[model samples]
Target: MCADYLLELASQLEFETVSACDTRDILEQLLESLAEHSAVTDIPVDEVVLANLHLALHQLDAIARGRGRPAINIPFHVIEGYLLHGFNVKEISELFGVTRQTIHRRMNDNGLRKSDVYSALTQEELDAVIGEIQQSHPHTGYRMMKSFLQARGLLVQTTRVRDSLRRIDPIGTEVRALANRTLRRRQYSVPAPNAMWHIDGNHKLIRWRFLVHGGIDGFSRLIVYLSAATNNRAATVLEAFIGAVNKYGLPSRVRSDKGGENMEVAQFMVESRGENRDSHITGRSVHNQRIERLWRDVYIQVLDQFHILFSNLEREGMLNPDDEGHLFALHWAFLPQLRRQLAFFMDAWNLHGLRTAGSQSPYQLWASSRHHEDPDQVEADYGIDWEGPYGFDDLGHQAGQVEVPQVQLQRHLTEEDMARLPDPNVHFMDAIDIYKATLQQLMQPRSEVDEGGSDA
Candidate 1:
């Protein structure tokens, strides 16, 4: 019976019914007796050993039946944060890698609850939405913030959003609410994203190095096109404007400040869209607030560092403000880098969540609001989504992929014209190649060669 019991104990280990931690002495006595009886007559097997075995098996059996399975525990704050970010329970479960039952239990245990109103209005979404507005247009007060959110399908109480804005940015809330209690402001409206576009040039950095020209859809606030060129010429602006038109299809109206640099754009809009239709409107820069507002963020977010760097270079005598060659080198070298920064800003701005145009990013607004008018939803309208928000069906519009169509319209140009056109979207390696070649030529010490390409 002792040997049979020992065999049974060994068999239990094979079937994984043993708990090594709980029954650490499972074989202690069996091994001691075996060692003591080595090379001698077998010691009589006894109930003491059998009793110990029975106790060990009982302990192992209890552990095997007990509930000691590994647990899945996620922090309450983490779930709360997800709820605050407008994630539904399903979404949170997927994020936490847990079941809905587990989530519900956790919520109940933590004394947290999400109401039906929370699911519908997404109050946490409002907090984020208002925060985005305060960030982009810091001067926007709480009342306007409420109107903005309500306009964009977020129907939150004014008091609620007001409190959120105050919480998110107390200083901005106090300062904006206190200042400009009354100011004359023109009413602005656009029926849709491509209904009208506002274009302008940012000259704040003109003294530093490059000039940035950009266009924004009035409704969606999408940065249609942003490019930097060395000169603020009419042709340059026209080229970018046309590029935008080709990419986004043509806008119903193009608004700009009455700068001569925009003459070509105005003419193009008038010619393409017709002057009788009010296709182009020129006014004071202040009246063209759509694109003007974009410049503030662009300068602060992207160009500020470059401005300081350039200013320091000039002040330190590393770059002479008067040297034509120095300016040329600056243009050739820094222009590409500036274009990249502008590209990043364009993407960041276009994809940034908006306060006024719903919580949707500019690109999202553009996608949803573009094709709401023309019933030819099954087709293209200069690549337009006419007849109501016929967004990209084949593939979603990526933020960084916003580019003007390179379709050379029905026009003829010489090689000189083509070469004179700025390629802001040039490949990085190609620019580096040209940069090195240009640097080599500029830095060449040609003491041995004469002007005639011969030794003097």
Candidate 2:
């Protein structure tokens, strides 16, 4: 009776000749008609036979939809699991009793291709790992992300990491594209740690401007020092340079932009070397690309994060831009935090391994190179005094502040100190005059009383 019933249903639907696209619809119609017109007792329906018929229908539907070959009823999810577990199309075809073409077609149609570098984990597991990596290092690229994961004992391929990044952190993907677009193909190298150093300033903050003067060793990319100051004055630049020199002798050559802020430092370096041989003052900022690139990392790690917070606070009217005190107050609140964060970033950057540098950190590279150089020849070449604390009395004197040894160790100079610092050149003098004028304008009374009349 079940066979007779099935044959009757097939006759009504013409199942033998139905196109693939219309198979699912036709099958549904047949089932509905049978349910409506026949009773279970009349048809004597058997679950196994009905299931086989449904499987056949599904296979026909898949073939008609151009998803795979006809007469194969293996679920796409099962095939995906096989591919994910290191099974190839040929093996899967033999296992499923289907041709390799059918397996390939099904896999491609269902988006089950193993496009990533082989990882032993399931898709869900890989996604979870990628998500964790993105959360930890939001600005890191796929290569670095893969390294970080490998460090955690998960051997993931770079291609897989890139795919994960594309799915989970599209913004970072775009950021990477923009970063690469701006890259120049120039190559630079140095033989030793103190061969050359690059210095620059960053002004990415809104209300208050801060100086980020840092030096990167040309050979090892070791960060000599990263200092923040309230103003980008010549003295501020010198202070940062002195901080680096005090810790690790002088660089043979110092490089910086032609900005007036670096003029005095450049002069000092040339004076120390007793010639222009050690000073590289270029008009183009890109020539100091080493330090310029360092700023990009700081922008991602520090400036951009704080900018978002401070911007939100400003929009909410909690911070008053009109009040001069508000600026210094927030500076005091934020600059110390920024300094601490930058110190951490410096240590992490110096210690983190780089593939190009033979998988050694900048510090390791510098240390190894230092071991090879003769101490006397090195000291003579750079002419480093290597004596008592490198003096920054000039900064204090020029800024009209008492040279306090203890305060010198502090991260930032007081606003009063910055205000008293002598203007380096005509442009600085103009800025000072404008600032004074603005203050005077703000301090003037808004309303005046008449001499012979009551207050109006």
Candidate 3:
């Protein structure tokens, strides 16, 4: 086309006498041709295009480059979508199906870009948003926290929050860091919740010390068991677990840390802990190690901040700043006498604690099994059919009087399941030996008792 046009121009004018008017007209025609090419095809002629093209040609001159210069495959949908939406970096990136960095480069090439809009927000608005976010979720990233405003009809994007957040927050760098999931290489379980259970311990410093041991039902993601005590001992662990078992029934498997309390020999015997075991505990499971580490963030970051606040007050000779000082004093003194209190709190945690995720108390989850009552429905006599709440006595009476429907499940056991089931194994023998040792320890009575016959 170029050759044909040049030939016609040369014929129309003098062959060698080139005029400024002719050159300008030819250049304009070439520019129009290039513009038409950009519109028709996504050849990715952006800011970097000319310089990159020149570099490629120069490199090819030295050594024939294999493969054509890597032209970015800019999809047409991206460009059209950006134009329709009034292109912003994030929207543009979304249009191009690429990152903001890509959009930034594309805009630079096209010479159509704007400075970040987050900076345009007033200081008061920024403070209000940031304050609300911090109050709601201190641990949440700025990007994630922006949805609070967006929910209330503010045009806040995660990126905008992220940029503005950096200015006001000292931990702005950390906030941005958290936005990116760089450490997503951690293992993920199956998609379903009931596929795995995560258990862990956390130390909570309230009025008194709390060693929180908890279990979540894998399928329900419900708090099956929660024991908050002054101490996370084997006995407390057993009680907490027993409560969960009595409530939720035995899970397919129980997962926990290798802590002495969780991996207790006696507890394992009761559970028959192993893969494919007939015992309460199931086989092949992931443990609560992840949650345990998450607590480091909670304890060090959340609780530690409180601790610092209190410590600063003490250092300034202002003990009991507000009523919190009394609470802090109680906490300081109560840590020592916390063990006995833990036993009581363990039961309370199961029965009274509210769940942050579900907004239902642990007791509510357990009590959901109770029968429904229809007060509106009346008998022939117009007596309200108030099925008395199913308390322990009611359950006993119902069991004795009426036959509740029972499901009898039957399945042919696989070899793997059979092998996993507990029976007369070497461990069982060792358990017997341990029991004998315990008996000996108990049976060795006091000297006076040993000499005497039966007690008076």
Q: Which candidate number has the best TM-score?
A: 1
lDDT of 3 by residue, 251-291 (tens): 43455534556555235534443433322332111223333
lDDT of 2 by residue, 1-456 (tens): 233344555565465564545656766776666566447425433333344457768777676677785566566766664444334577567655679999878877776666642558776788897786455347877655664565454556557777888888898799998987786544455557776777766666624544556778877888888877677677877887876765566766776656777777788777765563545444345345666667777777557766776677678765555455445545545566667656656765665556666556676566546422322222222422122121111133211112111112112434643453333233311433434433333333333212212342
Best candidate, lDDT: 1
TM-score of each: 0.47, 0.46, 0.32
Q: Would you give me the overall lDDT of model 1? A: 0.61
Q: For residues 1-456, could you state the per-residue lDDT of candidate 1 as single tens digits? A: 234355666677668696554344656665566547543644343333344454554555555677443355566766675454345577567644569988889899988887522335465766787776555445556654554554354545546877888778898777765654553333455677787788877766666447788999987888889999877678889989877765566877777767778889989887876646567776555456677667766776567766776787688776655655555555665687788867756765654455554455676567545544422122111222222221121133211111222212233434643343345356543543454444344444444222424522
Q: Please rank every candidate by TM-score, starting with the best.
A: 1, 2, 3
Candidate 2 lDDT: 0.59
Ranked by lDDT from best down, the candidates are 1, 2, 3
